[model samples]
Target: MERLTDFVLRHKLAVVLAWVAVALAGTFAAAAVQDRLGARFGAPGQPAYEANQEIMRTYGGGLVPLVAVATEPVDFARLAPLGRVVTDPAFASDDGGTTYALLYPPQDGDLTEEITQILGPHVRVTGLEALEPEGGGGISLVAEILIGGVGALVVLAFVFGSPLAVVPLVIAAAAVLAAFLAVYGLTYLTDVSGVVQYIVALMGLGIAIDYSLLLVTRWREEGHDVRRAMATAGRAVALSAATVAIGLVATMVLPVPFLRAVGLGGVVIPLVSMAAVLTLLPILLATVGPRIDRGRPKPSRWAGWARRVIRFRWPALLVSTGLLVALSSAALGLNLGEPTSDSLARSGPAYETLAGMREAGLPTGALSPIPVLAPESALPVLRAVPGVETAVVAAPGLIEVIPDYEGTATVENVLASAPPGARVGGAVAQSIGFTASVYGAFPPMLVLVSLATYLMLAFAFRSLVLPLKAVLLNLLSLAAVIGALVLVWQEGHGSEPVWGIQALGAIDEFVPAMIFAFLYGLSMDYEVFILARMREEYDRTGSTDQAIVRGLGSTGRLVTSAALVLFLAFASLAAAPILQVKLFATALGLGILLDATLVRALLLPALVSVMGRWNWWLPSRLSRRATRRAPAPQAGPTSPAG
Candidate 1:
């Protein structure tokens, strides 16, 4: 370990340059082949999502789903224009407007059935509510300025004492913004959804800024000379960035085009931002020289408290245990149900239009149900099921049924209110066999996938207790964010008075889960990385108390800096025009803040101290792997005092 650290320190410049070069090459290749990189999400034979184009051309229209309006007492004039829209040369229809035919071939049989059921009842509809026009309007302008500009300003101020912190964040933000524009450009060349492009850009920016912040913060703390510090910090952060890339890269396993794009962007942009940090940030630190540290305020009272907590054993234990109790309760309140389409609209103008239409007498009941597409011959059998609401045969193999709504609203609701088991799209897809219903079962399937992820972490850490603790901590953060989202976007409790947007219903179905998946992985990355360092220190020294303090204090600047970079990266997502992306960005960025401050800084240290001997405890069966013992609890600082 000493040799590794010494080698990293000795050739910091070479190491940093090597990282920068590789990252640059990757970014360039990714951008150049952005079309191909994106193409990886499409059909089995073809590259990209070009299949969506053929679906669009054959079915006639674009890739986005259209929402149809159905009412017995409909406003003829208001809906008159929609009749033409339904039959327009640009549009396609099936089931006598019972189904809003895809502009492309149906992605999945279940999705097609679900769409048919949802539209079956509607008499009027439009292109799956098109996003506000390009270039954005006044509301978008305000959102951008406030959410991106002001939000970034406030966070930078809180995290870094000097204005210099903003520099790397700005660079990261620019790199991310450029990446988005590049994605937008790729859409012209390849068949990419606008929303997917929007998400990719935001994700790229947020992560880049975040990782850069970690590097710069460490550089400032360690280097006697700014250049050397920059080099050292850059090397460490670059490695950290690589780990993050690995975690995000794992997301490619998902079949959805948008998720794949997000995962790729998450990997690509961080590497890009890392290059900028290694090259630009270090140069800037050197050129700005000593001025970079100028006008820094006295450390806050909390900072002092932080130092003391890190040093003491019982206090640390108390803090961690306390957090565990409080956050655990919060996690208990989590509402993990999928967000309805109405909820998704809360972010933009389309929401109000939908509400007006609903008031004008649309079926504004529960969320759209799952649509079951089975052999038309099975219609009676489905209707015989106790919960099935309405079932009808539309095509040769199609039988649509709306189930009696339940609180959980599982995929059984297909064709009426949203499908049951839709929460697990993959499992549903697998269960149904073929490539059918992948999207329908996504909502339910993800819960299992997330659980599987937790298990993997446990297996890796080799501790039933520690993995549970990590998951519980992450859940706490997730719940807090969800509560905040519900209040801000749903009930509209204080949105207008606070953030200046009217509250919408639920967020998108995919938004919350994707955010959870992305952040859960990212948060775990930090936990693993930091714990690895702490464990290494404990292995060397027999003092648990000394190890806790030194481990935290030594990595203090690293964690703090990394948090800032990550925060910036996430905030960049909030800058996008899409409300769904903004929600995801806000939730994820906020999650990082909570994790870094409350979870890592206060909670983790406290719990470690409290656990004492038990922190590294393992079963006798695993005793062979536990060759070394952790330090026993002690009362004082162990660092050699200057």
Candidate 2:
């Protein structure tokens, strides 16, 4: 590490130029990514896929008409130019004005505008096509980053009280852009979800800044000695990145292509950030760290807070534990359902057109009507279903069923009740299959993540008890975050006023697994940062109390500051146009903030103080060698940042 830092300092200018080239290439790659990206949530081998393949085989491969409405008619001849294919005359409304039209979304051109121009004001258009572009725009995503960057700068300046604080933000941006470049290349190899773009951009921003914060803070603490700081904090950050990546990489094993792509995208953020932080960070610190270190701000109050916590450790532990437990209890009420089609893209033709139709006294589910293809022999049984509104014959053997306003019949039930050769499909069936694909594969994926993370942390901390404690605490943090997610998104507490996120009633089914993997791994990262230092101090002096005090007092502010940077980055996601982005942004941001403060700063130090030597205890089979892997920091001069 010392040799690496020396090389960086020696050729700092060359290092900067290389990164400049990297940043330029990364920018171009990010720009081209969106063209290759898509929003397919369908998992291969699902029932929905089979149904679609059959449909394509029966009719030439294309989207069928998705919506139909009854009202005064327009000139079908005039709509012809806009790609509105006039339907059979017998299928018209009771007053002879209703006609169906085809609107294929996710296409190359602007289908939303064309649909509006062709249908005009009187005719109603709804269904999946109503939602034009899913998720957020480049402009809104940029706004999120800019706003988060500002918030992170404020926290960094206050925490370090130096212009060098901006160094983390700079490194973070480069890491994020670099990850975007990697993901862009990834899109060509595999069909990457558009969600991966937001995750890499937003979450990567926070994570990269976090690793940078630790390294920079350590440099300041080492009296601006870049080499020694790199040798110490550098190792910690690398291990930290690897440990977090373990959980992320586990997602690749999931059968669902959507989540597997997300997992693959997630691992890139930490790796890129780790590379940039270790290489470019040292270059910046070696060249500019001393200059910015001059005129540090007045003494931070964190030390005083640390002392108070140590003195009143018992009370702090009881209070924080009680609060965390209470919050986590809300997990029991979580409703595990996926986001509705309405929530996919809230500000588009798909959403607004439905709102207009609903206001005009149309059936609530009219936009998302269902089609049940059954043999003519079972037409009576299909129409007998309570939710069925209209049953029409499309061909000699095919029948289409439009559901009513309060359709409660699901695809599973509809399939079971259908005639032997019948099939039910459309938006409703697709949603059900998507949800099943996500949830059905969840358990095995979770087991893989949990078991792997546990082993990694056990190897890292070198204590069975300590690793177990870390896992349990991380689970608690995840549960609390899930509760918070439900409260904010499902219950609508602080959702509408802050970001216009409505009461969703139920969350995206994939949210819980995501929350668990991300929060557990990140919280463990902070755990390693704190406990590694504590273990180092204890090894040197064999005094648990002294080690706990010095360790927390030293790393507490930096860890919390790093957490704050990530929280701000995630908070920006709440403003995203996509419902999934909003949920992810809000949940992750809140979770990080909560874990860093209440869990890490207050609860952790207090618990270590109470546990004393037991915190470092390991079974005989693990060996004393496992108990101590890294050496204690050499006794030397300390700077103001500590």
Candidate 3:
């Protein structure tokens, strides 16, 4: 590590140039690729995939398609043009024969109208239909998902208060543009869907910026010079980022094609972005070395306060543990269910349209039906189960039913739905044994998967107690965020006149699980990163108190900075023209801030204070040889920012 830093210092200019060139090339390539990828994985214009044309036309409103009709009657003069809106090139036919249309979302304008005109009359116009483009519900979802993200940036700006802080954001923007362009160019090589590209863009940008923020901040804190900082921060962040990338890649283990695309796209972007941060960011810092320190305020009272808290061990521990347990219990009360489109929608063109339609008494829930599969007319037998409101055979071997909505799918299964929450996924799959079909289990399965993931993370961390603690802490954070979301979105916490978006029904089925998986992993990332540093400090100087104080002081700024950057990156997704995307982005962004500030900074620190020597008191047999080494002196020089 020392040697690598030395080399970087010696060759700062060369290193910087190389990184810049790569970023530029990558940027160009990514731009080209994004266009190609958009052509390949972009939203389907129709529901059919024509190998001959090498295109997949999208159909319906997507996922649960929204079928709405505004009271306005079709005008004979405008019918021809209106038909184009419904049959635009963006709307494709599906095997299900579902009628679909793509509106020119106002954000994407001219192109949408041009496409709508091209389709010409084979389409139908619906509620508050506009020939001018309008954003989609998915975009609104993106906005909601990003709420916490924007807040995080504000928090980050406050935390770092340094000009260098902006560097991460810069690196992030360049990395994202490069990634999108590269994905676009790849379209020429293979068929990529437009929607998939957007997903990739969201996942890639969010993760890349996060990785960059972590790398750059750590680099400055650890290395003496720009180049050295780059090398030091690079190695640590690379390993950490790789771990996250690996986890994301693991998503391919599931059978969903869209998710697979998301995973693949996610891995590529972050990896490349890390490379840029380690390389170009250092060079930029070197060139603007002194300037990087501009706007950096002298350390604040919070730093001193945090340091003091670490020193007074017992009080900190009690507070942290008590809070953790309390919040963990609240997390237990959290409702697990699918998120609805309304839950995702932001106050935008798409949301406004949806609101107007809902006010007209249209069922906004759409077709979020639960499918029950049984061989040879078993719907009658299954319907006997409690909470199974009105079951119908939607297709051969498929039974659709309305859930009681009062209990989780797992709860309903036990009382009347399927089985206990624990048995809902694999157990249901095993019990049905190819005889019955299902759909709504996706949300339930997601929760189970996340639970299993937490177990794996616990094993990876090598301490049952700590991992368990981390999971519970994460749950508390998630619960608080989700609960707030539910109240605001479902119960209409602050609606009426503030935002204008009414409370949608239940949450979307995919949201909780998605949030759980992503946020849990991220929270763990932070826990491991911060804890690892503190443990390193403790190993050097058997003084847990000093270690916590020093460790937290050093990494606190970096961690908080990284969290802020990640928040901004994800929050950007809210700009997307999709309700689900907006919601997902907002929720995730918020979760990160909560995890970094409340959980990592306050709660985790307090617990360590209480634990003291016990924090590092692994059984002698479980302790590794390295951990047994003589303690280093506590007077080593602190790492600097550039």
Most accurate candidate by lDDT:
2
RMSD of 2: 5.8
The sequence of per-residue lDDT tens digits that candidate 3 reaches over residues 423-523 is 11111222222111112344455455456645554333333345556656666776766765565545556332334445554444345544654565566
What's the lDDT of the predicted structure labeled candidate 2? 0.70
**lDDT tens digits by residue: candidate 2, 419-474:** 77676665557656766777677678767767776777667666655676777778
Candidate 3 lDDT score relative to the true structure: 0.50
Indicate which candidate wins on TM-score: 2
When sorted by lDDT, best at the front, the candidate numbers are: 2, 3, 1
Error of 3 at 395 (Å): 14
Q: Ranking under TM-score, best-scoring first?
A: 2, 3, 1
What TM-score does model 2 achieve against the real structure? Answer: 0.83
lDDT of 1 by residue, 463-530 (tens): 55555666666666666666656655555565455445455544444555466556765665466545
- The TM-score of predicted model 1 comes to 0.59
- Backbone collision count in every prediction? 58, 3, 99
